[model samples]
Structures are given as C-alpha cells and as structure tokens.
Target: MLNIQSGSTEFWRAWNHLLRPVSSRVETPRVKLSRRWKVLAVAAAAVLGVGGLPTAGAASAAGASPVHIRFSTGGATPPNEMEAAIFSPELQKKGILKGYDKDYTLSILTASKGTPQTLSLLAADQIDIGTLGFSTIALGQAKHAIKGGFSVVVAQFVDAHPGYGANAYMVLKNSGISGPADLKGKVIGTNQLGSASDIVLRAWLVNHKLDPRKDVQFVESGYATQQAALNSGRVALGTFVQPFEAMEQASGKAKILFTTAEATGETAAIAVVARNNFLKEHPKAVKSFLADWVAGLQWLAKPENRTEAIAIMSRITGTPTNVLGLVYGVKGKDYYRDLKGCPSAKALQNGIDAMVKVGDLKTRVDVSKLIDASYLPYPC
Candidate 1:
C-alpha cells in the first residue's frame, strides 16, 4: 500500500510537470494544487530522512554525518552580549554543538571555571574544545594533559581601570603609592598560582626593576576576598580586573594601580585550546563551528550593532551597561582581529619567556605551534 501511494505521488508529480505550460505561466487551481502537494511530499520525506538535506557550506564538507562538538569557554559568566545572542546561537544551529542543561554540550570547555577545573575536564575527556588562558594552555601542554586545536577569543591590551580588565593591579587610595615602584615592600594579591594576574604581576614587577621574589609579596586572593582584604588592611595592594577595582574605589577600599598594558607596553592575553586526540578525530566539525563563530563576531562588531552588543555583554557578564559600553572596545580596532591573536604570538611567547626567566616555568616551552590560527576566517 505504501509503495503504491509513493508510486502514485511520483506519477502525479511527473504528469504535473508535463502538463505545465512553458512561456505562458499560469497559476490555475490544478497547477497550484500540484505545486502545493509536491512541497508537502518533500517536507514529509525530509522528516523521515532528515539526513538527506544539503548541509550548509561547512557541514556539507562532512557530508550527512552528524558531527558532535563538545565546546567550552572560560570566565565565571557566560559569553558577553555579542556572544550569547549571535555567537553561541549560530554555532548551536549546526547541531554539531548543542545546549544541554543550559550549558553547551559541544565538545568545547572553557577556563572560566578556573584553571584546575579546565585541565581536569579535558584530562577526563569531558571537554574537547575550550577557551584557555595562554599560561594555562602552556602549562597543561608541559604536563602533557592537553594540546591546541584552535584559537578562539584573544586578549586585548587595554589600560582601563584594574578589575575591569583581566590583568590589573590595585592599591589603596591612601597608600601614598604613585607607580609600580611604590609597591616595593608592599603586599600585592591575585587569585592563585598560575593565574593571568599572577603572571602579569610578576612581569610588571620585573619591568619596574623589582624582584617578584623579594621586592613584593604575592598574596593569594579572590574578587570578594581581595576587596575585603584591601578594606580590612590585609594587603596594601592587589592585581585584578575592573569593576572590582572600580568597586573598590567606589567603596573607598582600593584604586586602580596599574593595567597590564601599562606594564608590558603591549597586549598580552590567552586563547582557546583542544585536546590532541579530540582535534584529530573531529577536525571538520571544529572548522565548521569556528567559521560560523567568527561570522557572529564580525556581525556584532559592526558599528550599528555596538549598542546592542554592549547591552548583551552587560546582560551576560552582569556588568552594568554603561560600564560595559565604556570598557568593551571596538572589535577589529580595539579587540584582536576575530580569532586572531588578541594576545599576539610575539607577546605570548614574550610573556612565557618572562615567566621562564623569573623561574615560573622549569623549561622554556615553544608556543608557536600551540596557536592554531587555521580555524579563524582567512585575513583575520
């Protein structure tokens, strides 16, 4: 019976095409019915053999195979404005990456959950793709825990207030501190060992001719803890990003001491990484996801989209819209070219070398190969 029905459908379709007049198109009832029914039939078939549809450009490369991408990112909060609305949504549509439990299940993981968590997730194969801090990625590679797949978000060097930017140094307003040199014999704080703030602070200290080991004391602290520490006089100074620095000043606890850009004279930051085996196994899906992800960034970077983009980033990061707008810079001009080095290779290698020189790393690791720029759109 099913075969007979199918045969009849095909016969009618063919007959409809034959009877259709050429050079004299007419939307007669019969022609309309035929076209409508044909569309219905195709739709029905698509539901049954959904895999038969032509995948979009990127997906087309892999044929009809359903590629599963486990994606991750860093930062305590979800992607800022442009990312949630434009970036993540477009990528998830590929079905290669999907949201499970409000969290993306794409083989991607990020360092936002903290360095240790990121490493553990990758080591257990729970996450395949992740946005990682450059320092974290290098350290993980050294320990043989994970490797690079593609570079995602890059760090922009901004001299905005500390705590707003990721690598900021803070000091109390009344500490009588004027510059990096004033911090000598004073206490500074960061989240933990191997953090961006930790590494950048050391670099900053060395840049000012102070020894990180002796001239300054490194105190382990958190956002809330750092604010509290500064308030209670636990530490004379600290290093962190904005809002925290802004908040400290707002609350009359601390002031923006220095931004990483001031110390390094260049933008130094982090990137996304993939586990070795994961990258090898699912290279196609990786490329597709990135192509669309970069598209979203480009779209959001447009001048017309700036207002909405800032609102979105503010919503996600919980940073005030006013503050977010001021802090988040223009895309191509302020931020790194999409998927290109936010923290350029030269800067990252320099940072790593600085770390090694300060005895932060046992061996100087080569990071050039670690940055997979192929995932980004050409001319990035």
Candidate 2:
C-alpha cells in the first residue's frame, strides 16, 4: 500500500528511495551505439531542442525496447489512486491496459507536496509525467520554472462538477463554528500551502470577505492527520478529500462547513501533465499510454466491475473496502473523470483566474495554450 503521510520523514525517505533507478529494472538494452557517439547525439539533441530523434515507440517498433515513463501522483484517491490500474497486471491480463508492457512501462511516484514537488521533479528531469493542479500550472508557466515547460496532456480529475463529489472543509459538529465568519482568529489545517485544496480554501475565505493571511492561522497537516487535529482542537477547520472525508463523515464527529465547488464552480482540480521535451520526443508512446488510460477508466466504469474496482482501490490505498465504497466510482459521490482522458481547458482557466483574484498567483496564464489535447484518446 502507498503511504501518504507526507509529514513523516520516514515517508520522504521511502519515497526518495523509490525514485532511484535500479540497473536491473531496465527492460531492454540500448541500441548498438558507441558511448562517445551516444553522448554526442544526446548533447546535440539537447542543444538543438529537436524532437525527430528515435523515440521509445520507434525503438520498440524496431524490436529494441519500450520506453520507461515515471509518473507522479499526489495520494491514494481518485483519480490519483485509480491511475494504478494502468500498471496492474490483472488489468493487463484482462486486456484493459493493452499497452502496459508493449509501448511503455510505468513507474508511479508519490509526490506528497502535490504539484509543486511534481513541478520540481519535472525541472530536474526526474519524472516524465506529473498530476498537477491548475494553480501550479499557472505558477510554472508564469515563472518558466521547468525546462522545456510542460503541457496538460490529460485530465486526472475534475472537482465539484454537477452530480459529483467535491472536497470538503469540516469542523467538529459541536464546535459552534457555523460558517466562514466564525473562523476568525482560528487555526485551519491544510495539506500544503499552495496545494489545490489550499488554493480553494483561500479563495473561499477571500470570497467571504475574510483575509486568510490575517484573519486565520494556517497549519500544515496531512489529510490523514487532519481529523485528529480538528478533534483535538488543534485546528478549527480541516480540509478533506476522500476517503478521509468519507471516513470523517462516517464517524459523525465532524460537519461540513463548505465545499470547493461552492467557492469555485467546476474546476479542474488536477490534470496529467508531461514535460514538453517528453511529449515531443515520445508522442507515440504518450498516445499509447493515454489509450490504455482511457481503456482502464472504461473498464472501471462497468457496472459489473464495481466491486472489483473498489477492491483494487482498497488494496492500493490501504483504505477499507467499505470506506472506499462510500464514494469510489459512485455517481454524485466521487470526483468526475473524463472517460476520453481529455481535460477541461475552461475549468483550468477559471481556476487560474481565481487564484490571481485571490492573490494566490502573481501573474495570469493562458491555460489553453499550455494544454495539448491532440494526444488524448478522443477529441476534447
């Protein structure tokens, strides 16, 4: 099971260990090229910013080797957790993920800091694909923080769409904090300062005429620990995503104060992004991966697969089946995912604009230009 307790040093250590490459894990040998020529070729490609070089797909077609793709996820939740299905041998056996070991191999890395950490990894060339939030996309584009930049290739999940579940802000049922007005001079817990949830929280607060910087104190806490922090009076409000939200609501100890949808209507909370160089160099492999991704989603959406889908998520996230069943794949109780793997440019643009209005972003970004929908399984 994936451990998402990001506040723990041990978790970071384990995560970093997983990021290191192991020679034995290489799926195939490189093409027969001298070391000096290979180094020169790489240097020339880097200097020229060219994309016509042999890619994983081209090499694999020539019976060489499949491409290795390192993808990042924030935690064990939809659609982050659901992405594990793309790597499941069971799914591959059933032909749900038809391209798993053919066109590309996948390594799903956990980035607890969410988009910021993912962006850093992209800049460092440590990750090939990352699930990033709208605010992070804006920040990266505006600052040009990543080499070759990145493009939104597919949708991870959409928050607060009609008939879909939205992330919640919860407080103890009897805490007497009825609304945002009562949060003044109180501490609120967040997963991270610039995370999607945190951005929404800040926007909500600003919309309510409260200054998040001066009216309330912010404390960093993982979603796993927010319930305890709230119950112990360490924080008056705790931001929650599923299955933590479902678990907390089931406990009957907390009540929902507001939801992210109420603050920003129908936002693209997260999307799958890839570095520009990777997209340009491995277009065929990226498209094949996306095809399998859409296929996986289709397989999970089957009514007959509900039980097994829940079980798969349960096993991956270490959450009980019953807890995950509360919202996993349930219409109106889970985040919305595009079956075709196309992300909503309009929603992302709105989210970025909201961040600027809330002072969370210094500059605005044209999200449409940063999105590459041509690689999706179908038209956007």
Candidate 3:
C-alpha cells in the first residue's frame, strides 16, 4: 500500500498518473502492472513492473517486517534483468534472497512514478529502495530542490552504440521528414517532458543547430503511445527506447533519423537507490540484495546461459523470445554491468551538464558526491 507524502506538485501529478492500472489511458508510458500479485511465499508485486524485494528483516527471529524496496522499470523493455534472476530457480537455488520474501512481492509504493516520486518516497520513508535515472537525480540536485534522504546503490543499465538514442528516433515511413531540419517547426514527442527521452532529444537537436525550445514544439507523449501518436499523425516525430526503439525499426513502418549518442556518448539506465537511514541501518541486507542481483547479472551475461536468460526475460516482459534476443542483445555483445554497478563517472557528469545547458535542469550537480558507491557490488 502506498503512503504518499508531500513533495513538488509536479511530482505528485506524475505519481498519481503512474498509479493507474494498465488500461488507465494515461498520456505517460509507465503503464500499470497486473494488480494480482502471485503469492511467492514472500509478498506481492505491484502493477506495471512495480515489484519489490523484501529485506533481511523478514527473518522470523527478528520479528520485524521486511524492508520493502519498490522498484520501477523506466525503459521500453521488460525491466527484468534482476527480476528474471531473482525470481528464477537459479537464485531460488542459492536461497540468498529468500530471507525477505517467502515469495517476491510487487508494490505500488510511489517508486514507479519517476525521480521526483522516488525521492519523495525516500524522504517520507514510504519505500526503502527504488529505480531512478541518474540524469533525473542530477538535474534535481542541480536545481537544489529535490528532497534529500537517499544514496545511489548501483547503476541500473546502459545502452552503447554509435548513435543509439539519437539514431533510434522513429519517423513514420514516407512521412517525407528526412532529418532534424524537418522537425524544426513541427511537434516532436518524448516519453516525458524532462527525462532521458526529452533531454536526449533536445541535445540531439541542439547539435544540429536547432534550439529545441525555440525551433520545435516539444510535447509529452508517453512511451506506450509514442508509436500510436506517430501513426495517428499526432506528432511529427516520436522518440523511443530499447525494444520500443528496436521494435519500431523492425516494423519497417518507420525510419531512423540520427544517433543520439552524439549528445551523450552512451545511454545510462535507471539506478537503484535507498533511503540513507535504511541503508546505514542494514548494510548486510542491502549487500545481499546487490550481491544476488549481481549474481543474476553475471549468470545471464554468460554465453552458456543464453537460452534460459532469454526465456527469463521473455517471461518477465511477456515479450516474445525472438524480440527479446534481438533488442536485448542476448546473442550480441550487449554487455550488462556485473560486479561493476556504476556507469562511467565522466559520462554521467556530462549528461548532467547537458541537461543544465539545455535548461531541462537549471542547476549543475556534482556527480561525484551524489553517489555512495561504498555499498555497491564492487569497490568504487
């Protein structure tokens, strides 16, 4: 159950928006998860990829409720890297994560919304840990207004390519729009108004000498609806991430514009974070979770486990095996961070600066101080 707290009204609005069931018809891409949680002997999982892992407190002798970390998936794919492993028979065999969940639980504990929502929950102590975007955290800090009560645990994911996010942009086939120049006076859609999609798109435009704010009409189009918006002619261009990006390109109905990698060399995924007090109070439990998560990453990253890994991801996202393999890079060399949980510091700092220069974020955040890497899977 969610115990929402006070925070920026902008975030509250987004929080409420994320609380809807999958069919809510919201403009945002964060669709709700299945409300019915499978009883895993542990706890319940929330709607739309809003799942939680129980902490060490779940041990019977301790007689305390488990630490509930409500995590969210913030991309176009099945946010199931760890979920695939944690809930699978592999992790089940080790029994390393079993202390918390008789069964893994899903929670709608306000962490599903976005950075602001996650921060608010952290500040209020409503949830212990959740997934967040580094850019969001950095931009919020730069503005010097985000609620302060959490520390970064690990880097969530990453995408590296010559022009991944930028080149991943999709325009309807035969739309007559060839490049960034065509979008100068037209509406271009992003998953969120101030997220990776928005910032990356703007940065790509700026690189082309187009002032995103002045030259184009930037609109908020949820990731789920981005494709529809394009087909319906609601927006001239729709930005996508991951499978959504790969899916659109595969559909042959759209064409790539350019590579967004030009702006930020690589795309960093969401991060795992926890309330400062909770992290300090129970370091072992946190480490166990990270260790288990990293173990999962390591298993799936290996070539031998490729088949099961694909099946696991397919089951988690309900995406097909073929699509998962293609977009997620099961066969290809799409390296996921194993023991190394944090992204390149330089890349993240540059991302923060890009957001600031584009006015997406008003302040400059010191990326160095924002992370508490001491608790990560490896030494920082």
Candidate 4:
C-alpha cells in the first residue's frame, strides 16, 4: 500500500515546470568487453540459436484470431488500471487479442529482478508481452539478454522533480522534517537495490553532498512493505510515486518532502515490451496491440475521462480518489506519452551514470544499445 496526499503548493508547481529533461552526454559505466569480444559474441549468438532467432511460425498460425497472450505488468495501480482500461477494450474492438475480459491472462510481475528472476522471461519464452522501465530494458539488452522489442509511451509532463526525481520522498508530519537537507542521518526506504527510484534518489542526495550509503541508510521494501515500514516508525522517509504519495498525505500518515517533478521538468516512468519471439511470429498481432494501446493512451488523456480513470485506478490499487486526483494533476501532459516528455535520453543516461558511479553496474553501458526508436507509435 502507498500513501497519498492532497494538493500541492504553487512553489511545487513552478518547480516542476523549471526542471525539464535535457540531453548532455556523460560517461556511463560499461560492460568490459573488447570490441573483438563484443563482435564475436554477437556473431556466435547469431549462429547459436540466440540472436536473430525466429519465433515458432506454426504455433502463431494456429491461433490467429484473438491470439491468447499473457501480458505482464508491474505493481503500481494507477498505471496498471489506466493501461488496462485503455488497452483491453481497444484491443478487443480492433479485433486484435483478448486480455481484459478473458482472452489472455494478464500477470502482474513483481519488480524484483535477480539471478533467476528477470524481465527476459520473454527470451526464455515464458510471458509473451510485458512492461518495464526503459532503463531496466536497456540494462537487459546490454547484458545480451531479454530478446524483446519495445513500444514507447511518451510521458510529457512530470509534476514532481526531474532526473529521476519523479519519485516522492515523504516524511511523517509529526517527524518535524520539511526539506531535503533535513533528511541527513535519517533512515529512508526505496523499493530495492538497482531500482530506478533508488538510483535517482541517491543522485539527488549526492548533488546535495549527502552520502546516501552513509548519511542516510537505505532499506529495501516492496510496494506493500514500504507503507508498513513508514508507519512502524522504522523509517524516517519513504519513497513512492503519484497516488500513493497523495493518498498517504491525505490520510495524515505522511507529509510531502519533495518529488522528482520538482527536480526535473520531464520524466517517463513506464513502457510496454513485446517478446522477440512473439513479435517476430505474430507481427500483425503486435502491431494491433500497439495501435489499440495508443488509442487507450489517447483516451486516458482526455479531461472528461480523468476522474473516471482515477477512480478505476483507485479501485484497482486501493488508493483514495482525492489522492489519485492530486497525483494525476501533477503528472500533467506526460501521463499519456512516452519517454520524450518524461524519461529523456539525458535523464536515462544520468541514471546509468549514477548507477555506475555507485558501483551497481559492473561496467560502462552504452545507453544507445538499450533504446529502439524504430517502434515509436507515430510516423507509421
């Protein structure tokens, strides 16, 4: 469960508008592979039934009409319901595939990724479609894993701070902490190590001259555990996105400390990914999915649907309407688009660089290898 809050002040509003995403190249940690090793790997993988491998044509042809699929998503509710409401109907109406009503099994994949559990469940031929942060997808690609293609949803406006600042840092109102600097020496909570929120938050701390690892200890908490950690007085601050932050504040359980919108003007937090095998075999199905999904995104952006979208999201996530509303307002235009408006290349590269500086990434990663702009929903 996440905490949500009411409306924000004008300063918070103005701050969000100022910190937009920008493009500036910075040296990021890369995987240590000589050019020869890299070429050899690509070549070997190409010949060894890995890279450029095609999907099973017979299976795809067997299930042409409303193909059965298992689309995986994350835990956050607003994005979940918003995506569901938009995509499910559009997919069915467009004669694509079945998911929302019953044609497919939509699995909610937890954010935990490690030794065995990874987003590459697609490469392993487990799930057919899923969603992941662009940064996560990029990391997977650089590792020579996760054979998938992506469809970007550009998030145009981020009401919170920028440069990974899209997440909120909250404190209990009674804790007497009001600003970022006040968090010195306090215990803070993030989803986990290697999480986007963790990386960005650490960068914010570093910019402020605070040693995230030393000055403020970070604890790993899942979506459900984060709220519990904060309520138990075990954590002075907890990080979360949108509706959760608003809901917590509205309930008087927490206070707004700061948000990524307040730091960076642009931010992108979500993306839809299709497995390479499925995408290759069912090209038409994949295209249909993107078309419907784009329609869904457009519908969700409408002012008339805003309230209903928020309610649907609240119902799914168990967040309050007021809190959801606040979160929605802050997100602005980017709520409907892809990374161009939200998680720009500059911001993502910053994340890569931050992770490298913290020694989380083993080697330098070329940011370009992770993104595939060839799949943008427009210019079709």
lDDT of 4 by residue, 1-380 (tens): 11112012332232222222222112333335555545444432222223344222323456534444455454354552244555443334654443333322232333233212336554555456655553465566556565544433233222233322256777787898877778888889886666656666776777677887688887877654566788788899887665556556666888767665443324344445565656666555555555555556565666887787667666666777766676663444124344222235554555566666665677766654444444344642
Per-candidate RMSD, Å: 18.0, 8.3, 7.6, 14.6
Q: lDDT for model 2, on a 0 to 1 scale?
A: 0.77
Ranking by lDDT: 2, 3, 1, 4
Residue-wise C-alpha lDDT for candidate 1, range 174-258, written one tens digit per residue: 7898887788888777766675556777777787888888887777765435777876777887655544544455565566777
Better of 1 and 3 by TM-score: 3
Query: What is the overall TM-score of model 3 with all chains considered together?
Result: 0.75
How accurate locally is residue 378 in candidate 2, as Cα lDDT from 0 to 100?
Answer: 88
TM-score for each model: 0.66, 0.84, 0.75, 0.68
Q: Model 2 over residues 1-380: C-alpha lDDT tens digits? A: 12223434544433333333545225444345555544444433322222344322344457665776667776445534467755566587787777777878766666666678877777777667888878888888888988988899888778898899988999999999998899999999998888778889999999999998899999988777788898899999999888889889888999999998888888887788889988887887899889988888888878899888878777766778898888887888888888888889987887888898788787788899988988877897
Better of 2 and 3 by TM-score: 2
Error of 2 at 186 (Å): 0.7
Name the regions of candidate 3 deviating beyond 4 angstroms: 1-66, 79-114, 143-148, 161-167, 330-339
Among all windows of ten consecutive residues in candidate 1, which has the lowest summed lDDT?
1-10
lDDT of each: 0.53, 0.77, 0.58, 0.52
lDDT of 4: 0.52
Provide the clash count, candidate 2.
Answer: 0
Winner on TM-score (2 vs 4): 2
